[model samples]
Target: MSFADQADRTLEILALTPGWHRLRDLRPDCDDETVAAIVLEAANFAEGVLAPLNPVGDRLGARVVEGRVKTPQGFADAFRQYAEAGWLGMDVPEKFGGQAVPLTLHAACAPLFERGCVALMMAAGSTRAAAHLLAEVADQDTANEWVPKLATGEWAATICISEPEAGSDVGRLRTRAEQRDGEWVVTGQKIWISFGDHDMTSRIGHCLLARTNDQPGTRGISLFLVPNEIDGRSNGVSVDRIEEKMGLHGSPTCAMRFDGARGILLGKEGRGLPHLFTMIELMRLLTGCQGLGLASAAADVAEDYARERRQGGRPDQPPVPISSHPDVARQLHELRSTTEILRAAILELATTMDIARLEPQSGLDDFTGWMLPLIKNFGAETGFNVAGAAIQVLGGVGYTRDWPLEQYLRDARIMTIYEGTTGMQALDFLTRRLWRDEGRGLAIFLQKARDEIDAYATEHPGASEAALAALDEFERLSAGMISMRDDDPDGALYRADAYMRAAWSVVSVWMALRLSETNAVAGLAAQFAFHSARCA
Candidate 1:
């Protein structure tokens, strides 16, 4: 399906979600018609303005000239148009110069933008996420100063966590912030900083974590907002160099050096990691959107190619479209099924997160937390796998630069690695989400799935049966892993990947059942059943 089709399906799924009315009531301007229009406009902009830049950005990439990073040609202009269109602040609060629409709407629109040009969208995501982070954690004055700038895209931002010594082990970071003359100064070298240096915006801010005291590990780290320019002058922030990455060449991932750059502390001094999670969570969710965008695009390409490209047929007859072949047909069904189900799942999570924000006591937060890691990891995997599968369907032509599948494959490779590796997500799911949370989220998910199955069982017995069985298997596996938590934590960690796979299978079944209720995608429900069964 195309990105526009995905957006329309997202609206269908959103209306089907429980409590969607309540969410709609909260954001009156985000009613179904309004959101549909917004998404349609976004789709048009993404296709007309951003899609053309995808290949250009990949080919030209970003370059550094005289210490400043220059994004690929048209990137800066495209971002300007994007900002002017108010795309950056769709979900940000109106108080901070945003439209403050429901995140579900943003989620629906995001994949389209990502599909258009993920490389440029990297800068957009961080800026928007950082604006929300500041609105939540920074001091009123600090938020007032930065949030609007970010919301309007007058400036861009980066979440600086990884360093030479600290990648996933954030505790070992050596960046330091010192208080001097009633001002904070940060001194550090941060690597793997996306949009670390870009000409898309005049000012760039770093949501940096730096050691501030003698406390050990993460305890000593504090969050700081360090700008690249202060009072129209350089603030001692310099780009040492931009990495020559395998993909996403339009986004300049930089190795940055801060030589005592003036900084403002955000949130509590010792709660940097916890505070940063605000931004990290949103980015992780967006990573899933990124994956979905690429996967959808790949599916569209493969399906189109299969219908047009003809090859083998009976010797006595003329060649038929490859899509007529059983193998190609099956692959197309699986691809479409996986893509649509993942879209539903991501929208569900996004809606759940919206509900969690609206009603803190609703217990949806735990459920959202439970599903975040799964979506992040599997979402990334789906994009890469789908692109590879699409390449196969297109034969040798898909592997060549003439097609976008290869670029999509290369670009998607980082999603699994960056937000948190698949291993990291699995470990987090098993240890923190399942074990530490006491399976509250798991309980919520299981009950929810069972409710859906029971609701649809009479009409869709086949889908319900498959879903229930998968849910039962998932529950049993989860219990087994949880039981091992005390006696064999290491063993549980070892089984984390398996447990996560099972969770994805179960979730896929649930999503397939959800999609089965919709007329447009009902045919793919059986495909999901087969896919889930095989994966499980």
Candidate 2:
């Protein structure tokens, strides 16, 4: 079925989900129509502007110069189009040269960029997110000065968190931030800094994660807004080199050296991690969107290929496309189904963020805190699988440059690795998020899912019955598993992903159903819901 037809069904399901209804009602302070216009505008811009570059960007990878990197030929122009169109700061507060689109709308914006190239998508988005962090935590003077220009895309930004010695182990990072008079002098190496030396912006801001020697473990690490150029001059910072990566060649990932760089700190002195989380979680959500975008692009490519690539077939056949092959069809189905689930999962997280944004009274902050890793881990993993499967659908040709499948695969691999690996996300989710506040936050999430399922059944009799039946089996299985592991907290902890899956299946399908019911907006979601069930 056409994606539009599928969107109709998907939007209907969205209408039924409380979260979506909440989105319709919240609709930001802006009029519903205007907010929606921005949302559609972004989706269209991404489709029209960025989407076209996916294959081209792959073929014309970024080129490294003597001291800098230049993005693919058309990349800078397209990025300028993207930024000048106000796509760069969709959710930024309007007070600061941004549209301040609500989180729900911002959530919708992500898939479009992801469907583009991650290198470009993240490059634009990371700056937007950085602008957000500065708004939230930076001193008013700093934020006022930076947020406006940053929102306008006059500047680019990167989060400098990793060192050669520390990737996930943030506590072990050796980047040092020492107080010098009224400012900070940051000295250390920041590895794997994306967009590290691109020429798109006159200046770059690095949100440096450094050890302040205040305490121990993760707490002592502080976040510093270290400008690559301080006071209109290079702040003793130099790009050591850009790494040769497997994919996402359109974006330059650099290793930077901070030579006692003068910088300003954001938030309280030692409370950096919590403040930095303002950006980290936001980036994780964006990364999840990145994964989704890559998956969507790959799937679209695969679908088109399947419909065209003939494998010993006649035109008269209904399923003559290579997509007709049982194995190929199965792979496509799995990929599509997983994509739908991940998308549903992402929308669900979006809903949570919307709630957290619109109704801060809901205490959904902790809920979102728990959900960050889920979106990051699940979305990244699915993108990897989908990209790989897209290549698989093309056989030997997929491995070559003749088709974009290989580039898709290569670009997607780093998604699961960068922005925190799946294992790290899962581990963080299990050890920290799940049990924090003595599981009170988690219980709320479980209850929310339960409520969503109940509401779904109430709205749609037959499907609700089926969904409830499935929920019953799942709950029973879950309870039995829990009972079996009553003495084994470790086992329960280990089973987190399984538990999350079963929980998500029930809620996710309901989310699809809820989205399916909405008829008032762009109908892609409705098409998505029906296709989800068909693909499932």
Per model, state how many residue pairs clash. 0, 39
lDDT of 1 at 114: 95
- What are the C-alpha RMSDs, in order, of all predicted structures? 1.8, 4.8
* Model 1 segments more than 4 A misplaced: 517-536
Give the candidate number with the greatest TM-score. Answer: 1
Give the winner by lDDT: 1
| Cα lDDT, all candidates | 0.89, 0.72
Q: Write the per-residue lDDT of candidate 1 for residues 485-525, one digit (tens) a residue.
A: 88898988988887888788878878877777565355455
How does model 1 fare in lDDT? Answer: 0.89
Instruction: Please list all clashing residue pairs in model 1, or write none if there are none.
Output: none
- TM-scores across all candidates? 0.97, 0.86
